[model samples]
Target: MWVYFLLVIAILAWGAHLAWRWKQARDFAPQLLALRQQEGELPPSVSQKEFTDLYLRAEGPRAGTYVYACAAFMTVTLAPVSSLFNSVWTAIWQATGSDPVFEVGTFIHTFSFFLAVMGLTILILAIAMRRYYALMPPNLRQVIRHLKDAHS
Candidate 1:
């Protein structure tokens, strides 16, 4: 019961955090545009599409931090989420007074295990890529970027 309560609290906290971030981003957009205009990074009277493209170009690379945070959070929360799901399913089963065709706990455990594995894999890949990029020579990196642009 305490675990269930804690899980609910954690979920609500995460949702609130996400909402706060979304609001922050929303508030920052116009400011970012204005700043870019002042810095001559963007022309005055830019269209929405042009602003979007510029914003993505400027901010997209930094998204890896968010991805890594999410992956780590997912990996950390695996046990709690699995426990919550199994508890909920067990309560429902007891209320129903009927045997389930398959063991819900087993499925929940397996699903959570796979989710953790995926999260770990993402974290590992991100770390490896970051290290590889950091170690690469600047000239080589620039060449790779040019090749990527040509392909695009």
Candidate 2:
């Protein structure tokens, strides 16, 4: 069905995006470490928490974009997944003479429904976090600007 096709495409696109992000992170790691160790910046022996804080500050408002994107993706794909699972359940019911109490299709449908609820929750949380971040002070803007300059 068209839903299945769309689901496949969405999955493939997500996989490609993840692969690209992984490649970018792999390439950027050395530069990020070098930037961290530079004079007047974080020391070579910086603690993990300190480094993470610096990185998050450097990312500024854009840090939440990844979470927003993932939540949106889940929101968009949940319906198709649920539909597919429902179709599977129907097919299995038809193939089997009767619907068993502990059928795989029923389990899959329940799991997919649970995932859909979780995805909706995550989407709502992402939206709330985005609004909260938007209202936060602009102190991190300076860190983001400094990191851009250093990268350039």
Candidate 3:
């Protein structure tokens, strides 16, 4: 069926994405640690706790995005794997002429898909916030001010 075909493609894509994210996180660890160390050198006006809080506030959404991305990958792929198990179980049950047990697999598949959608929503919001910070208007305005001052 078309659904099964699409599910297979989705599973492959999710797997690849997860792998790439894992590597990216690994590569970022040292840089993150260095940033944290630099934060410790802040002046007395900024307490270590305040600096840490600000850092977390800035980085929290990005961390959440990665977490949600991983969760989405799992939820998207696991539902169909669960379905495959259910199908095998049904065939085995039929072969033995036994009464079929109550199946919750369909419910799980639906619930997993719902969670995957939520994960995607969170990921989108995080990405938007990340990009917003990347293009910080205030920082750009400061740069423009310095340039104008130099020219004047």
Candidate 4:
């Protein structure tokens, strides 16, 4: 029960981390775009096509970080939990014999669910951030573009 609770907490933390990164990227983007507009190169309100292109370039890498961070966190947090709680889990497994193939299925199901849950969470965050971007003022958005271009 404790191990399961810990796992749940870690999962929630992973979601929070994803949300945080999405907020970071979403906030930074408009700032960068606005900076660009002020410099008179990029426009504030980008066309959908332009926004798509920019999002593809910038959001792609940023999103990867969120995914990897969550993965790393899970790996680290679960390793100790799994190691310490193994005897308990093993006893329960042996006593119940819940399913002959549960040994394999447990691993598959746990990993799959973990990945799927985190992936979906991050995807939703990205979508939300994208929608927010569309509503941002154009000039501010341009500033973000300029700042990004300057950095690169």
Q: Each model's RMSD to truth, in Å? A: 10.6, 10.2, 12.3, 11.3
Using lDDT as the measure, the top candidate is 2
lDDT (Cα, tens digit) per residue for candidate 2, span 55-74: 54443334444554565566
TM-scores for every candidate against the unseen true structure = 0.39, 0.37, 0.30, 0.37
Q: Clash number for every model?
A: 0, 0, 0, 21
Residue-level lDDT of model 1, residues 64-127, one tens digit each, is 4454456556646767866776776677767778466435646754676567568666776677
Please give the CA lDDT of all the candidate structures. Answer: 0.57, 0.59, 0.52, 0.57
Global Cα lDDT for candidate 1: 0.57
Model 2 quality (TM-score):
0.37
Candidate 4 lDDT over 3-121, as tens digits, reads 86777777677667766866666556656556555886665455434554464355634444545555555555555645545555556667887566545347754575467557755
Clashes of 2: 0
- Candidate 2 residue-wise lDDT at 109: 56
